[model samples]
Target: MQQQTNYSNELSGKIALVTGGTKGAGKAIAERLKAAGATVVITARNKPDQADPDLYFVPADLSKRGAADSVAKATLERYGRLDILINNLGGSETPAGGFAALNDEHWESTISTNLLAPVRLDRAFLPQMLENGNGVIIHIASIQGRLPLYDATLPYAAAKAGLINYSKGLAKEVTSKGLRVLTVSPGWIKTENVKYFLERIARSSNSSIEEAQQSVIAALGGIPYGRPAEPEEVAELVGFLASPRAKYLSGSEFVIDGGTIPTI
Candidate 1:
């Protein structure tokens, strides 16, 4: 049960860009920002399947070299300024196996999507934020960065680890400059893709979906909260962090993992 209220326009007069905003956590974040009263722009390799007239769409593959620059240019040309940037485009399509199963291309693509894409986009957009003297940049990392499931997402984990480190250093460099940089690392979130993956695992392992889910929990040493997080739950935290209420909060890694990592 959640309470409804007449929302304040906390993000009124602001502009936000969310990469891979067509689906999953990215979509939730984009919607949350819009509800907060920001003019939101979304970028993906293709336009969304459904029409969303409220959001401006930019089509670009963030893994490519100049895509970030093109997106930044278009956004600035249309809106003249950007106040928030959410780097939420990341995944591992690498085949499930250990290090020997991964080739150079696998490693390169994973690193490009998970780490370099955000770096390039941040570099492209940070100058304007610096000139304006205030902004927020969020890197959507994963618990895999710290507690890796090597049998499947080794490259993704390695890349996210790099992203976490890069985000921290960038935050330290820019917090004094009026731009707040932060990282949000989520655990197993209940998204469409995750549901489909669990189904596939259930079929392949000749197990029930419940068993398949448990297998994942066991692999992560267990999620004490008892289930995965909803994408909207992750989005809520992002919304607060992007708000003026979190003004003094920067250069931090916020983990929304339901106590999945056993250690402090």
Candidate 2:
């Protein structure tokens, strides 16, 4: 917490809103923003494992449409200004198999979580950022959006693809007004969510944890780095992008997947 405060000019004195920031990449981004002298605020459906007294935490399930508006309103009420927005709240709640395995509820839930949640939050917060004529918004996307895992996470991939396209379009629509929108598409991250996926795979198949992990890597077409990315690595990118140093960088898709993803 104490070490994350150095900034390269773009983040000083800015107030930021980080969705799903209580843990994982979200937490890493918040801590990094704080280190850069930004007033960082986070939100989640529940109190996270590593919550601290100094950090701002807003509890709300972002899957609900009203939750986005409420969280944005709360940020204004609490901080009076919003300068950076990291839309990091996204996931695939449904299990794997194929299209036949997913029901209507599962598909809807995936789209809502991975696509619509940030869209709603952006709607709630962007007007002010636009009115101010300067701000940064980063969306955490996935490489699966382009390389679809049709057997297990097709819907998740589709929604993430929509998110990437949406981020680009949103950037185009808002950059003139001074809001810079971008997407960070990570290949595979070794977060708690990845651990959960590994555990599930281990349970369903007759394989050890290590084997399940290898299976996932194989499914991703084998990461050239041979390992998943650390959350802090992604956070570092978010930190840089949110700063003034990256002022010219907008409507871009950044892939930090250890040289994974076969295509450009």
Candidate 3:
């Protein structure tokens, strides 16, 4: 028989910070990093329903001005250094109804949350990471960046597209200076919130949850894999990318959309 490889300590001495880590894919990513032996720090607007003792939690709303600086200060004061940064706190609260329904406030708020927050956080932490001569920055973007749903998530898609472009530019500037920057764009993730969303769709359409899910998938031009991705699956990709195994990877957007994008 072959011997089993013990890969649990890949990030034994690394310290990672994940934004919006109280729930959904953010929580999953934080957990994954922790399981891989990194000291994980998570920040969100609210406390997690069930706390994990191993992970450090900081309450913050990144959309507010100066919030990024506060979070960076708190983390650095505690850990002294950051090895990995995951910019994952993003969402749109704007009402549906296409461009005409939106106003300056809607666009500004959406842009601030989805684009500016990450930029501010990155600025706050970059000095230390650059001084250390090593670090990894991963931006959690969305597939909507490229394939946007105009009726509901236009601003969000635009912001994520900006993030993707910014991530690439940052990578070009930092990759030679000992920092790695990458983007992960995922499509419909089947999280707890998404389950509720599906339920609502089911009720509204007078259909089963499965049918509602299929309808949503169909609206996305179909996920070739036949389902939305699980939070853990996306977490797994982030874990690998943040590990030594992907040392050669940088300045690229990794799409975990299950082929929802029709064109290459």
Candidate 4:
């Protein structure tokens, strides 16, 4: 069982912008930030009917160029300043297949959503943050960057790998100036999408759900934890990274995978 820890409401005076905060890991991150007392604004392509009225929402398709600028403008307009930018939006929309199975469009879309989206948003927002002389940017990347599955996720893996590099470079560039840029790479997380994917695999292959799950795990080499992580677990890491408690921890990439990565 996981013990609940008080997050100190340390983010009391901060304002945060979390991309893709409607569901999954992004939603968890947004809620955690709110619990820590930050005024949060969220961006999404689709708005939910029961969206929290306390939180500001900006609608923009991040894969589209200039969307980030629009979101930044709206966030600043609503709050006048941004203290935290959480790049929590990404996925592999590519169809299943090896190298020859994917085309130019698939690659471009994957790269745009996974890598370019955050880069563009950061470009529009980070200048203001840097000028303010203090801020934190957290990029939510994936473990596929280091351990590529290669089948249908090559593009996503490659893009996340680029993001890791980009985050590192940006961190080094601005750390001395009092800005903190960090990356968090999560392993297989138990999201609704994954559950649906597994169900489809089970139905199509006429295999038990357990078997399909094991297959997914096998593809990852093996998960020592024996299962995927909860969205909240990933969110807790985001919370810590965004807190003042982690002040000296800029530019680091924290991998939260229950020892699954098999790396030092």
Q: Each model's C-alpha lDDT?
A: 0.92, 0.87, 0.92, 0.89
Where is model 3 more than 4 Å wrong at Cα? 1-4, 195-212
Scanning candidate 3 in windows of ten residues, the lowest lDDT window is 196-205
Residues 1-264 of candidate 4 have per-residue lDDT tens digits of 999876668999999999998888888888899999999988889984577976788888999998998999898887888999999999886765579878999999999999999999999988898899999999999999898877667999999999999999999999998899999999999876787767655765678988978877988879898789999999999998899999999898999887888777
Q: What TM-score would candidate 3 get against the native?
A: 0.93
- What digit string (tens of lDDT, one per residue) describes model 1 on residues 198-221? 775677578898898888899999
The numbered model that scores best in TM-score is 2
Give candidate 2's error at residue 119 in angstroms.
0.4
- Tell me each candidate's TM-score: 0.94, 0.95, 0.93, 0.94
lDDT of 2 at 240: 88
Alpha-carbon lDDT of model 2: 0.87
Query: Would you give me the overall lDDT of model 4?
Result: 0.89
User: Lowest-scoring 10 consecutive residues by lDDT in candidate 1?
Assistant: 196-205
3 against 4, candidate with superior lDDT = 3
lDDT for model 1: 0.92
Estimate the TM-score for candidate 2: 0.95
lDDT per residue, candidate 2, 45-133, as tens digits? 98878767757899989888799989988899988779989999988767666778789999898898889999999999878887889
Sort all candidates by lDDT, best to worst: 1, 3, 4, 2
Q: Model 2: number of clashes? A: 6
